[model samples]
Target: MPAAGSSLGKEVASSGDDLSKRLDRLEELVRSIAGDLRDVKQQQQGLGVAVLRLENRPKSPADNNAEVSANGVGATAEVA
Candidate 1:
């Protein structure tokens, strides 16, 4: 039969191994998340540029008059 101290030591060693593996898996997950975050930042930068370009574009008269015009006709025919 094994001594009580030796049995305790085996249990502690097995628990330590389990903890080490879990830590390694967590580290991998963290690295993957960091990469995803970098991609999101890059996409956000592109979207910001697109939004700025749209904002700087000239406004069309049609866009300005989405509602019925003062002449009581569809705005496009009135413009013509």
Candidate 2:
């Protein structure tokens, strides 16, 4: 009947609106997560640079002596 068809049409329209709203919310969440991932990647790059600098820095004689003692090798040798 006409009344039944009208009710079904209204239901379909309401469902479509609900789906659109949910899709909008999903898009916002995806954007926020992408921004967060970019920040984390930048921080990781900074840490990598700092680690590389430390690794390339020269070691003092005392540091060398300590490392030698820890490894139980050349413990008696003078560092000069």
Candidate 3:
């Protein structure tokens, strides 16, 4: 029932709204990825701190035995 010009105008407006919605969704996804990266960075820092502490601690005889095993050479394996 609408005039041809008005119908064309309505289609353009609808397409603009769809584009706006898609852009908003893309922005939301980018923000989510940034937040996830922050979380991963924090976890990596925490792990680094824990590893440093372990490395600085004095090693007991039990730890020495485990360290040898950690190098992939089991107690039963011959060493050069």
Give the root-mean-square deviation of each candidate in angstroms. 4.9, 4.3, 5.6
lDDT of model 2, residue 71: 98
Q: TM-scores, in order shown?
A: 0.67, 0.83, 0.74
Location of the lowest summed lDDT over 10 successive residues in candidate 1: 71-80
lDDT per residue for candidate 1 within 51-75, as digits (tens), equals 9999999988886665447655664
What shift in Å separates residue 47 of candidate 1 from its native position after superposition?
0.4
Which number leads on lDDT? 2
Candidate 3's residue-wise lDDT over 36-74, tens digit each? 999999999999999999999999999988888899766
lDDT of 1 at 57: 94
What range of 10 consecutive residues in model 2 has the weakest lDDT sum?
71-80
lDDT of 1: 0.89
**Global lDDT of each candidate:** 0.89, 0.96, 0.94
The reply for model 1, stretches above 4 Å from the true place, is 58-80
Error of 2 at 9 (Å): 1.2
Candidate 3, lDDT over the whole model: 0.94
